[model samples]
Target: VEISQILLHQCQQEGDETADVGPGGDYRARNKLLEHLITGDETWLHLSTAETKPESVTWKRRSSPVTKKFKVQKSATK
Candidate 1:
């Protein structure tokens, strides 16, 4: 499934209380919850409790050239 779908599902599973942090609250809390979910940890996801508008959630996967080269070099070295 897509990351957004997984995230939204996770939020729903955790319940509305955790997903309903009002705007302007601590986004870092939400980010932390998302991080745990993405990283496959067992932490709870919490929504921000501020009065600001909710931020759009998005996800992207990035690969590192150094890691890619390292993998290739390790195979060559082997």
Candidate 2:
């Protein structure tokens, strides 16, 4: 599928990058690349918790129904 092809392309690109700094290659470029490169593992985390339906209730007059605004909590990515 598309995912597999994308992963394959990434692997090939990684191989090419390594080859650039491998034996008989430009070691200086390797150092420069390493200095500027940033790497980290992909992680998903909940930065905030969303309120439940009951927790999202709003106080209003008996004869007047009021609208409740809900807060949306999104996940953090790296």
Candidate 3:
């Protein structure tokens, strides 16, 4: 029971199906639930596979002794 508690129980069952709609419900099932909703920057969170400019090249050996190149950021909470 973990993928973040099944995505918080499917986002609390889609917030109780949008709080069961209202004022007499069913406008074609609320426009088929807002026409298949998909925004969050159109969604794509692969989360990992990054280094591939020749696997982030790093083959120094002409007296190899100079290391400190940390500057690759992307995640201010998505």
- lDDT by residue (tens digit), candidate 3, 1-78: 586676666665665343344577744333333446555665444454468789777889989888786876654333
What TM-score number comes out for model 2? 0.35
What total of clashing residue pairs does each candidate reach?
5, 0, 0
Q: Which ten residues in a row have the lowest lDDT in candidate 2?
A: 28-37
The RMSD of every model to the true structure, in order and in angstroms, is: 24.0, 8.0, 9.9
lDDT of 2 by residue, 1-78 (tens): 996687666665655354245567755333333445476888777677767899977778989966766667587765
TM-scores of the models, in the given order? Answer: 0.23, 0.35, 0.23
Q: In terms of TM-score, which candidate is strongest? A: 2
Using lDDT as the measure, the top candidate is: 2
Q: Residue 42 deviation, candidate 2, in Å?
A: 2.9
lDDT of 1 at 23: 78
Clashes in predicted model 1: 5
Comparison by lDDT, 1 against 3, better one: 3
Clashes of 2: 0
